[model samples]
Target: MSNTQPLAGHVVVVGGGVSGLAAAHFLLEGGAARVTVLESSGRLGGKLYADEIAGVPVDLGAESILARRPEAVDLARAVGLGDDLEAPATTNAGLWTRGRLRPMPKGGVMGVPGDLGSLAASGVLSAAGLARLPLDHVLPRTKVGEDVAVGAYVAARLGHEVVDRLVDPLLGGVYAGNAYEISLRAAIPQLYEGARGGRSLIETVRESQRKAAAARQDGPVFAGIRGGVGRLPVAVAEACRSAGARIETDAPVRTLRRTPDGWEVAFDHDGTRETLAADAVVLAVPAPAAARLLAAESPGAATELSAVEYASVALVTMAFRRREIAHALPGSGFLVPPVDGRTIKASTFSSQKWHWSGAADSDVYVLRTSIGRHGQEADLAWDDTDLVRLSREDLGEAVGLTAAPVAARVTRWDGGLPQYPVGHLARVTRLREHVAKLPGLEMCGALYEGVGIPACVSSARGAATQVLGTLRRAAEPGAGQ
Candidate 1:
């Protein structure tokens, strides 16, 4: 093999999502002789999907990239999409609770209020809830041994109202999980580290706010491409092909096995069964699929992966005439607290969030609602027509938006978000330990790291690096001596 081609042999990446595409790109860049991507579905991009609504393209899955992190942004620029990046017009979010819309309290970490003045002024809490705030300052430190549920720890320090109104809604937006069950360390590591320091949460949040203000980070917290985030996969895939990677759709891997030579990946493509031997393999599919594929090699990893749970949800997008709506949208969107018994958990004023989605003189306004979360899948059982109707009813009540929509579309995502419960970090540690035993085998995706696009890309890139390192070490002269 040539000196530049460290990972010279063939490599296969199973799963055509952004993670898989990213793996292919990294592998090709790392000098792999040949690479192939196998995707079960006819399409790619997984949850980073987009579709047209009212003649305007809108994201049906993850729409925004957290700009605070550089991974997703840097990747987009690398793939020739730097000029297309667009920041949101607004970032304000309203909290719907107790029969009115309250402005989200400022100076909070994951909805944990840092300043009592802002919380009290926002009217997010009742007199009793406000009264409970000072107790956090004087009360004895709540013991958080190794790790604890975010809700349990926050509620003990603050109160249940804060957990329900603030923390739950915020956590739901990301993981669709219950704060009472999510691990503090895994879900909200910053807050977890603060709690571990033994200082009051209020003090911790205030300190965080002080640091944030000192830095004064400018621009929007999130950014999106002009067409849609879904375009990301297409661009990345094209880049991979330029680097000589083959992408195959409608290819579902049936089994994976480790061999003395390297690895064997068997799959069915176009009504034919096929197997390919590779110097390395990256499993970029979901947890369940990965667990099944890894079972033959490492049952322990499979068992732990099987134990991981996922959350499913649906997005209902509707287009309405601006004149038909009664209230002007003060922010990009609003979050619904679960305690309010609303069918829709959150609503994004799409037109307002992304300038390209609508025009100032345009008659139609596009907005989308998210429904169903962990333990809230019953709503998803209804048909699309019913889901659209329920979303309209809730939006009408929440924002006095009684106008009939000009057009509507519903997208269902089954097993979309993964839940990270207490002790999840420890479980992941054990999984990694077991996975390390098998060389030339690596796994990546939302199941192993954060659910956002950046996290998924980071995971995929890390896997590529690991496999490449192994191949490099094996190639060294007198390697086994």
Candidate 2:
């Protein structure tokens, strides 16, 4: 920090996920006198976690980062993981429809076709669906009011088949949300803005693809750490501690009160309660936790947060002997459309996708399948054995893998992904506007902007910057809130 930058009093950051840790990093970098990160869980990293299975280390949570967006990669490099960044060995993916797996069509954004011919060749859509897809080019411009659902808009333009067979599964995999309900503005702002301006929504998607393809000349579209993306929070926590920030695990904040000077936070530690005074507080936790902590200070924000629904998801990671599985498992894996009524939503060929994971055990092939999404919590209610059984069942049908796995592990994430309903962005805006009214209070996390790691980091950076700026100005000769 420069001499001119005032140390923004003590900051107490709730939650020790990647967002909270990243906030601590930025806050300390911006000259906070002190920063204390409180994590309710026994460990950090939240959804980004790694563990060993069958003698091979694999990401049990989120594994990849969208390198097309710079926030995550930038933070990785900033935390001294620049050289550790590695792109996936194969980006090619598949879509399982028509009772078989087909190559995921190229030249599209979120499965919205850019080139109809290629989309047809992929055989992802039926003949009738293909005939309906071109109708988008001649359809009258649809007025997309303030905001609309992604699936609703896409279905209207390209036909319900495309939205059901293509868009839903693609977006569903990312958000764990129903595409018909996820906000167009929040999930795909480019598509929203393009739809508002362009004569044809399909044409707009094609143009967006063209621009993205041209920009890809710089580098790959996605990246992962040499070990796992889970290392991010660990690295960020280390950086924060090195910069004089205190971090505590299993510290669940209980109360948040506005003080005359700043704020007071109460949390439990070692089965005992403790209080911490801070000049500012960052609520970098999930919606439910944030709502509970903010009930006293900002009930409106609390109420709004309470309404933000989340989806539960579970991953079944399995390892099989390379020799036992003679059938070729092509591509990274495949996405299963909900219309197919499948138990597993998607599968990733971990060994084929990441060199680090593959190199762990050359004789073993590692793969993982995800089960559950928005409105599909019941799917995760099954025991680990059931999940593994059904996942293997799907693998048998999809990839002809009948051999029993050498090992399998099920990791369940309750309330893992936050859903972005139609009015989500407006709700977030209102929350921020209300929070801005409270001095020394800020918000950051996946629930606010996006569910991706990069989006969470970006949100944390913005919150940290705003809090630091406010503190710096307050320290001026004649400053007022």
Candidate 3:
């Protein structure tokens, strides 16, 4: 092992997903001598892929980043791709209720009843359901400090109507996990704070609304790259290369070990075994993969990492002639409440949601349907053909598509999204503590904090700063001698 000084040595970033890529980009920008990104697959971006279908670009994995989360936008700007950003066509999404697409109850913050009149007027709740909502005003506030499942929290305050009709579908669409198993505190801290702040959730929401109304406009609601989200990773990779970072695809890390000098990373590249030594290392892979890489040195952390469960999901893209569909696909997308007993969880009007895809005269409509949630038994069972067939059937029934699709594609992600269960934050906190004990090491990915693109970028940037600080400290005399 070479006992080179930390500042003069390399930083190896495991995994080339958005998190890893962002970490490498930050490290390079912070003046790291050499940054090497090791991607497990042939591609750099882990789940971000945009492919052309019938001459139209379709995103298979991540679709858009919330403009409210400035991390992604800032990173785009730093990479010189900020000009390529495009806002979402519409923010209005609805629920498939009673065989009709009903607009989401207005003034509700992700399904929490912020306004009773708006919820009642939306036609989502019955007279009894509307009556149950006011009970929240009188319901006793939770006194426990421990985490509460989203299901219990919403059910207790807003009634089951709010949980089943609104929160479940909205959260299910995003996390793809059971509301009963998701922690309200971990999944949505703002909602939890609001609940704890006042005696009633309705009052809390009213206060939040006032604050939001008073705040100045920040930016767009959501934005995506002109072509697709995949442009983000492409631009990040280009930026890393320009900053003298080495990126190698198909270089899956097999193991990471701490040595007297620094860290050693063993991986395979094109059927050959290779090892690289670095002063610092960032394991930015998914929880499972990162766990495997760090299992030897940080067994406790690795164990906690491996404990985070991931749900398999498949994105089925179908295209049709505009005239072939009966209902006009409005808004960005619509989510199916679990009460609907629908195999399709959510459907995004791809062409209508973005400005780039659809044309007025083309008569082409694209739909991206998501299937398989955490507890929902997958109808297709990981088979691409079956998934596509199920998606088409569900879409046809829901959207009144009488004719077969003009084009169809399926992207299956086995264990793609990490499930943020009830105890997610505590588990992550423990893992972070364990990781901190391991010198020159960091972990960042969708599993730890959030699943969104901006969250991943934020994690990467944070990890990079920590790693850079460690390197700076070690460069001091007698620090790592």
Best by lDDT: 2
TM-score of each: 0.96, 0.97, 0.95
lDDT for each residue of candidate 3 in 1-481, tens digit (9 for 90 to 100): 1123326658999989889999998887777889999988888788888777767887888989878778998888888888878887777887887687788887767687787777877888878888887777666676536678888888877778788888888888778888888888888787778766655777777777788778737678789877788878888999888877899998888878899988989999989999999999998887888888778898999899889888888888888887878777668778888887888889998888888766523777887888888877556475767777777777676666566778888888788889988778999899999999998998888887699999999999889999989888887789755
> Which 10-residue span in candidate 3 carries the lowest summed lDDT?
1-10
Residue-pair clashes per candidate: 0, 0, 1
Each prediction's Cα lDDT score? 0.88, 0.89, 0.82
Ranked by lDDT, top first: 2, 1, 3
Where model 3 places Cα greater than 4 Å from the true spot, the runs are: 1-6, 359-363
- Give me candidate 1's TM-score against the actual structure: 0.96
Cα distance off (Å), candidate 2, residue 402: 1.1
Compose the digit string of candidate 1's lDDT tens values, residues 214-246. 876676678998878988888999888887788
RMSD of 1: 2.0
